[model samples]
Target: MKQRLDKAGVRFRPHFKTHQSWKIAEIFSQEGIRQITVSSVTMAHYFARQGWKDITIAFPLNLREMDSILMLPEDVTVGLLISDSSTASYSFPKSLLKKSVFWIELDTGHHRSGFSVADFHILTWVIDKLCSTGAHLQGFLFHDGHTYNATGIEEIREIRYNTLSRLSLLREFLSEKYPGRNFLFSGGDTPSCSQELPMEGIDEMRPGNFVFYDLQQLALGSCQPEDIALSVLCPVVASYPDQGRAVIYGGSIHLSKDKLTVGKETIYGVVCSEEKQSDMRLTFPGDLPFLTALSQEHGVIQGTAEQILNLVPGSLARVIPVHSCLVVSNMKQLVSADGTVFETLNLHSVDF
Candidate 1:
């Protein structure tokens, strides 16, 4: 994958929030992935302790964590995201102004936290303020998060094209106005990064979910089921022969409440029997056909009596979650590809 990315001239900075394990992170590090994108300051500290030199906290800056931000090494090259608010402008400790890098987030179309391209005055003012603070304004960062709402490949392509076009226009404007000012145009979302979208203006791509593609990504055409690298193992505890339903120990706490279904059938999670490890077949039995509902500690799998007759107590079933990000964030540990248990890395030790 590294060679493939290298051949495409796309610099990779995988998001560590997906699998918060230094051991998994070490794998990427061995592949020459020095730079990484994390979601929180706590995560930054965690990875920093793990010897990651270049880290970007991809989420909007939480000003309260300024002290934690300052604790990072000066040579580590930390990059933060800034919105239009004056909060971020004065949030950073003046002592580390020169040590940190900043990325002014632009709202291409995601309408999340960034200033829109149409709000040029506010953006320019924010840029000027950031520059005045003596901090390096690295570039513009954007995430086409709306791609997750895409219904098909065509809509996904439109989101990708429109996002890049807006960023490209902003990049050109920035270049013409502030000539010779080194600026990067970084943008990414799992769908945009995984697809054959044009990434000409994008300097760096940050796609976290690609590392462990989930069932939602598979349904969206972002990745294949084989590309999914993680799955939750649950023990089947009971079966209702008459109702054609089975109860699993896994619930929202383990597999998450996220759902991905077609029409009336609810496939809250993909089911894989233990026997089908090498060739896993995702099944949603007919009749009571659905991995329908999830409570705090149980997942109600609705299916036919004959379909679930073979499932017995103590049997292990693999469940693929709809969203890996939410699942991993809630889990305390992760099992590697080799079936080794690794403790989750703690992000922030001290409150900011």
Candidate 2:
């Protein structure tokens, strides 16, 4: 992934929020990935303790967490995102605000958290407050998350193009209004970055999920089936040959409940044979089972009666998650391709 980004001349500052493991981060460090992106201040501090100096808290600034945000280690250079004028004007510690770089989040048609390009009022308003408060405005950043909903490669390209076009237009406006200030335009989703979509004006690409593409990215044509890097190892506890379904010990709690529409059915994951996982090469249109349904602690695999018979109790199945990010958050540990087991700090960990 870093090779692809370097070849494309795009700066890679991957979001580490996907796999919150310093050990996993060590691999990225070995690959020379210096900049990092995370979802929260707590995560930023976690990585900071691991000696990550350049970090961006990708989520919008939380006014309530000013105490913790301000206390981030001084050795680290932090980047914060501001989604609206409210966060811009929110009471922030001037010391931290001055030291931190700020990126105004652009909506870019996602309808998620970001200032709309059509409404330059909010953009300029936030910029004005940043200027008044002496906050370093690092420029605009956006996430073309809508691309995940695209049907195919062509549709993905179209959505990404339109989103980038809006960010470029807004960039030009910012350039003209604030003549001397340089604003870096940053944006990317897994579908855009992994597909190597047109990213002419984007300064840095933060495609976290590209590290571990999942069923969703596969369906969006962002990655090949073989490119998927992680899967949940589940044990078959029950097999219903008559119904052509098998029950596994992995479910929403382990693999996440995110669903994707593949063909006519909505599924939570792709169930590949444990043998296939050992090979680490997944073929397209392969004879893998689909997870038809999921409960809190159980997953139902759909397959033919004959195929279901193969999943007798005590057997294992590898489930490729629909959303790697959410799945990783739910998991407490991971096993690398070479069979190296490492622990992960579950960002959303809770005691039952």
Which candidate should be chosen as best, given TM-score against the real structure? 2
Q: What is the TM-score of each candidate against the true structure?
A: 0.91, 0.93
User: Model-by-model lDDT, in order?
Assistant: 0.77, 0.82
Given candidate 1, what's the lDDT at residue 175?
Answer: 82
* 1-352 per-residue lDDT for model 1 (tens digits): 4554566687888888888878889889888899899998888888888888889899888878888798887678888889767665574667667667899887878888887866767778888888887778888888888888888788999988787677777777888888988888777678877877677767788888888888788878888667887788778899886887788898888777788765656678766543443343344443223567899999877666776775567886567778888888777788876779766753323332
lDDT of 2 by residue, 161-194 (tens): 8877787788788879899888887776778877
Off by over 4 Å in 1: 274-290, 346-352
